[model samples]
Each structure stands twice: as C-alpha cells, then as structure tokens.
Target: MLLLDLLLMLLIAYGFGFLYYGLYRNLSARVHGRFGPSLAQSFSDSIKLFVKEESTTFGWMFYLGPVIMASGAVLNVLFIPFLNQGESLQGLSSYGNLIVVLYLMVLGPLGNALGVGSSGNPFGVMGVTRGLTRLLALELPFYLAAIGVMIDAGSADFGIIMQAQSTQSNMFAHPLLFAAAFISFLGFMGKSPFDVVGAPQEVYSGPATEFSGKFLALLMSQSAMFSFAKLLLMVNLFWGGADHLGELVAKTFVLFVAATFIGSVYARFSTVQSVEFLIRIPTLLGIVGLALL
Candidate 1:
C-alpha cells in the first residue's frame, strides 16, 4: 500500500506537471496568436533530456542535488491531502504537518543552492543569492498567514485544518490570510512579478544555466513537482481539497488560472521591489488575519 501510494502521488504530480507545461505552450501561443507545439511537447523534451549525455563541471554533488530535490517534492505531494476523508496513503500522514510541509517546500531550493554554488558559475551564484534574499521577505507573510490558519483551526496539523475548513472554509473566516497567502503564493510560484531570481535577462535562467543533459532533466522534473506541491498546499488550505478528483482539479485549475493571470498582467519586479512589497503589504494583512482569527 505504501509503495502504491507513493507511485500514485508521483504519477499524479507528473501528470499535472505535464498539463501545466502544455498550458504554458498553449497560453503563450494564444497570447501571440501563433500555433504552438503539441501538448506532449514537454514529455518529448523530458525524453530527449533524459537521453542526452550527462555534462557536469562541478562534481557528483551537483548530480545528486537535483535528485534529492525531486525526491523531496514527491514526498511532499504524498503527504498533502488531495481529497477529504482520504490521506495520501495510510500511515504517511503520521509525519505530515504544516510545519514539516513548509520545510519540505524549502528543501529543494536549499539543495539547488549548494549544487549551483559548487559549480562556480557567476550567474548561478548570483541567482542563488537572489533567491535566498527574496525568500526572506516572502517567508514572513506566509508564516504569519499560516499562523492565522493555525489559530483559526487550533492546530498546525494539515488534516485538522482541513477538517476545520470542512465546517467553514478558512478562506471565509480568514480572508486576510487568504490575501496574504495569495500574495506570497505569487512569489512562491516564481511568477513574473516576483521572478527576479531566475530572470533570463539578468541571469540567463539563473542556477539552471550550468545544467544540461540528465542533470537538466532532473531539475525540470523537480520544478514541475514543486509547482504541483505548491498547488496542492493551496488546495488543502483554501479549497478544502474538495470531495472528488474532478472538484479538486477544477478548484486547483481556478487557482492556477488566477496565478497565471496575475503573472501575466504584472510587470516583473526587481528583487528589491519584491522584498519590499512582501514585507510591507502582505505582512500587515497577515497580522490582521491573525488578529481577526
């Protein structure tokens, strides 16, 4: 059962990732009024990446970093509830909690930082520095918002939070938290307005520039996995995980669409702008939510 559950979580994450990749292509094509690649383009790209020769200037740690990051993402997904009354798998929820999940979310980036730093690429190092710097401001609002949820629900356990939301969705009770989290979520998703860390214009894909071949494949997979994990976290926190897969998908899609729209409409912010905004506005709102709760 454990193995099966793990497989199911990974499969679902990968499937969603593929869908998002397709959405990216189709969305871009529509934006420009041009034809786009097939929906399976991401899958083909992954296949090609996997088969490509491994290239590394760093060391085995660089190779291992992405693997660890991807593993963390898969584990994170397995711990989040996708449907109420259903756990990722029996016994898996024993260790799952808001605190642990938040740490798990950071695990991948930490690994990437170490690996990228070891590479000695100026851009990779710069990107890593920028990412960690931005994380400081982004984290405060998210933490405050999470604390508001804990106060409203009376526990840090994600399952309990969901049960509490089942009575009344947290979104309604703590709209301020929802706003703060949504604001942080924009940064978490690495969308345009908060995407300074990996800006191609300045950093040339940032930490990922030095990676190619199998290493690139692992990084890409982990990125998608992280994206899905973030979405599931939002679903659990705001949408109650729904009662069925279709509902879950629909709600998740709506959230993603909101994110996409926000990402598209806003111009990219400088790292300083991102940090300043996160600290000043969302932080205040999160504190307000905590007070209200």
Candidate 2:
C-alpha cells in the first residue's frame, strides 16, 4: 500500500512537473511576442531525447549522476506531504521532518556536480564552480526563514507547522519571512538575475555541457520532477498545505506564473553579482524576519 502511494506521488510529480515546464516555455515565448509550442512540448522533448542514439559518459560516475538526481527528487516528493491533514497523500512525511527534507534537497545537485566534474569538460567544471558559489548565498535566506518557521511552531515537523498556520497562513503571519524566502526561491528556480549557472552564451550550457542523448533526457526528467518538489515545498511552508489536488494545482500555478513573469523581465546576473545581491538583500530580510519571530 505504501509503495503504491509512493508511485502515485512520483507519477503526479512527473506529470505536473513537465506540464509546468511546458507552461513556462510557452509563457516565456508569449512574453517575447512569439507563438509558443504546445503545453506537452516538454514531455515530447524528454521522450525525443530519450530515444536519441548517442550519449557520452565518463565512466560510472557520469552514468550515476542523473540517476542520483532523480532519486533525490523522488525522495523529496515522498517526504513532503501533499495535503495538510490526510493519510492518503502523506507518503513518507511521517518518517522525516523539514530538516531531513532540506538536506535531501542538496543531495542531487551535489551528485550532479560530481558527475559534471568527472566529465573532464572545462566548461562543466566552471559551471559547477559557479553553481557552488551561487548556492552558498542562495541557501542563507531560505535557511533563516525555515529556521524561523520551525522555531515559531516549536517543531520541525511539516504537519506541526501546517497546523500552526490553520488560523493564518505563514504568508500573512510572517510576511518578512515569506518575502525573504520568496526571493531566494526565485533563485532556486533558476529565474532571471540568478540564472548564471547555466548561461549558454557564457558557459556553453554550464554543468550540462557534456551530457547528451539519454543522459540529457534523464537530466531533463529529473529537473522537471525537482521543480515540482520545490514548488510543493514553498506551498507547504507558506501558503499552508492544500486540502485537495485542485487547490494544490491552483496555488502552485500562481506561484509558478509569478516566477515566470519575474524571470522574463530581468536579465541574467553574473555569478558574483548574484551571490552579492542574495547576500545583501534576501539575507538581510531573513535576519530581520528571524528577529521578529
């Protein structure tokens, strides 16, 4: 029964994740005054990539990178409860807390970094370096906001946090924390002004430069899944978990649209610029939020 529930969650994440990725592309194209591809384009692209004939790898580590990444994304989806109060959608949340989920979030990226490094591509190495540098600043504000929530609820459990927000969601109760987290979340989503890690013109696709064919396909698939996991995380933490699947889709779509529009308007930041801005602004907001808490 538990295994079946886990599979269902994976299916949901995979399906919605690609759907949103397609939406993101379509929306971005519309912003640029061009007709966009179909909403299923992302799914089609993944399938096409999977069927391609050629893929390159640097031994076992390269092969394992996407697998590890996908696993981390799956684990994240499992650990985070889909509904605030329900046995049906809880998955493995009972076995973990926010801290565990937080740690698991980084596991995939780190594994991917190792795989990228092993590829012997200078561009990939440079991209990985930029990513790690950006990550240091990116994590600060979100961590602070998360810490504040945990402290306020007096527990690290997601259900406990959700319960505390029954009367008022954290978005209202802790606006400063939400602001801090939302800004950092924009970076996590690889939106404008924080998307230096994979700037094609500058880094030649960054950490993904050497990946091709099935490896690239796996990366895309995992990325789609990971995107949903991040969206779910924010929804659970701030808006309060959803009561039903429809509500979940509505809340996450709103969040996704906001990120997409913001990303479209701004230019990409340099690695140093991204780090400096994150450290100065969102980090300050987070600190103030924690103090208020």
Candidate 3:
C-alpha cells in the first residue's frame, strides 16, 4: 500500500513539475512580449532526451550524480503528506518530521557537488562553488523560518503543524516568517534575480554543463520531480495541507504563477547581489519573526 501511494506521488510530481515549468516559460515569454513554446514542450524535451543514446565521456561520479539527486527528491516526496486529513495520500510521512524533511532537502545538492567537482571542468567547479556560497544565504533565512514554524506549532511533525493551523493558516498568523520563506522559496526555485548558478558571462554554465545525453536527461527528469516536492513542502508549511487533489493543484499553481511573474519582472542579479539581498531582507525578516515568536 505504501509503495503504491509513493508511486502515485512520484508520477504526479513528475508530470506536474514539467507542466508548471512549461507554464513558467510561456508566462515569462508573454511578460517579455513574445510567444513561447507549447505547454508540453518541456515534457517533450525530457522524453526526447531520454530516448537518445547517452554519452560516456565522464566518470562514474558524473553518472551517479543525477541518481543521487533523484533519490533525494523521491525521499522528499514520500515524507510529505499531500492531504492534511487523509490516510489515502499519506506516504512515509508518519516516520518523519519537519527536521528530517529539511535535512533530506539539501542532501541532493550536496551529493551532486561531489560529481560536479569530479567533472574537473574549471567553469563547472567555479559554478558549483558559487552555488554553494549562495546556498548558505538561501538556507539561513529559510531555516530560521522553518524553525519558527516548528516552534509555533510546538512540534516538528507536519501533521502537528497542519492540525495546529486548522483555524488559521500560518501565512496569516506569521506573515513575517512567510514573507521571509517566500523570498527564499523563489531562490530555491532558481527563478530570476536569485538564479546566478547558470550565469554564462560571470561563471560560464553550471554543474550540469559537462553532462549530455542520458546524464543530462536524468538531471532534467529529477529536476522536474524535485521542483514539485519543493512546492508540496511549501504548501504544507504555509497554506496548510490541502483537503483534496484539486485543492493541492490550485494552491501550488497559484504559488507557481506568483513566482513566475515576480521572477520575470526583475533583472538577473549578480552573485554578490543575490547573496547580499537574501542576507539583508529575508534574513532580517526571519530574525524579526523569530523574535516576535
């Protein structure tokens, strides 16, 4: 039963992730005054990439990186329940809590850093280093916000947190924490302004620059799934867990659209600028929220 539920969650996340990403591209294009590809374009590209033969120019580290990433993403999805008051959609959530989920969240990226370093491409190494540096700024405020949520609920369990918000969602009760978390969430989505990991002129591509064929395809596949898991986590934390599948889609879609529009309006920030802004605004908000709590 648990296996079946997990399988369903994985399929849903993979499908929805690509769909949302496609929407992001279309919306961003519209914001920039141009027509974009169809909503299925991203999914089609992932399929096409998977069908193609893989390149073997790199070592085992290069090959296993995406696997580890996918594993982390899978763990994340399984440990977060989709509905607040249901046994049907529960995965492995009963066995874990907020802190466990948080640790699993960063596991993939840190695991990938090993492979990115093994690639031995100067630009890739540089990109990974910058990405890790930016991660510190991204994580601090987000962690503080998560801590506030855990403290407010008086328990680290997602069920406890969701039940506590039965009367009022955290978004309204702790607006400052939500504000801090929302900003960090945008960075986590790798949206504009904060998305400097792929800065071509500044650092030349990124961690996946050297990968091609199967490896690159796998990375994209995992990225799509991973993105949805992040959305699920956010929705559960701030909006309160959904009552049904329709509600889940609505909440995540609203959040995705908001991030897409916001990302499109802003110019890309430099690495230094991105780090500094996260430190200044979101971190400050997180600290203040915690103090009030």
Residue-by-residue lDDT tens digits, candidate 2, 1-293: 99998899999999999999999999999999998999999888888998899846589987787788888988999999989987788899999999999999888889889888789899999998998888888899999999999998999999999998899999999999999999989998989989998999999999899999888989898888888999999999999889999999999999999999999999998988899999999999999999998
Model 2 global lDDT (CA atoms, 0 to 1)? 0.91
lDDT of 1: 0.82
List, residue by residue over 125-158, the lDDT tens digit for candidate 1.
8998899888888889998988888877798887
TM-score preference between candidates 1 and 3, better one: 3
State the lDDT of candidate 3 residue by residue for 1-293, as single tens digits: 87888899888888898899899899989988999999999978888888888655667887677789888988988898888888877888899988999999888888778888888888888778878888899999999999999999999999999998889999999999999999999998888888898777777668878877777778887888888988898899999989999999999999999999998888889889999999999999999999999
User: How would the candidate models be sorted by lDDT, starting from the highest?
Assistant: 2, 3, 1
Deviation from native of the Cα of residue 56 in model 3, angstroms: 3.8
* TM-score for each model: 0.95, 0.98, 0.97
Ten contiguous residues minimizing lDDT sum, candidate 2 = 54-63
| Candidate 3: clashing residue pairs, number | 0
Candidate 1 Cα misplacement greater than 4 A, ranges? 87-91
